[model samples]
Target: MTREIENAAGIPVVQIATIVPIMLTVGANRIVPGVAIPHPTGSPELGKAGDKATRRELLLRAFKAMETEITYQTVFE
Candidate 1:
């Protein structure tokens, strides 16, 4: 993982609450709040019609956000 990100410039690695606090304390740039433990994409219970639609929208938005070139903080909330 470290080898792959050697040329990533200023990438910020984050985990759940444990690593999240540490990352934030160190002033890292990005933190992606994962959806779940075993399944990050989603689950069937929360993937009902409406939920799936919302998830799809969120994914699309995340993808679109990758196009932006800003250097500030942003949250999906």
Candidate 2:
């Protein structure tokens, strides 16, 4: 898996997924809560501006998560 490879390579990975619980179950260390499965970064119902803002926020969270060091799995909302 990609996560496994990243972990083996010592790469700080930020995974974005609609199902945070599932990602956690699978041992994902850094996770960004996504809008949905179909649109992980943006939502169609939120319109252009809202979707863009949401994506930006998620990306920012991911960046922060990447910067922080953790011994266990972490989920960024």
lDDT of every model, 2 decimals: 0.46, 0.87
lDDT of 2: 0.87
TM-score of the candidate numbered 1?
A: 0.44
Q: Mind giving the per-residue lDDT tens digits that candidate 2 earns over 50-69? A: 99998889899999999998
**Which candidate has the highest TM-score of all?**
2
Error of 2 at 16 (Å): 0.6
lDDT at 54 for candidate 2? Answer: 89
Residue-wise C-alpha lDDT for candidate 1, range 21-61, written one tens digit per residue: 55456554444444555554454576478567755755665
Which run of 10 residues does model 1 get worst, by summed lDDT? 11-20
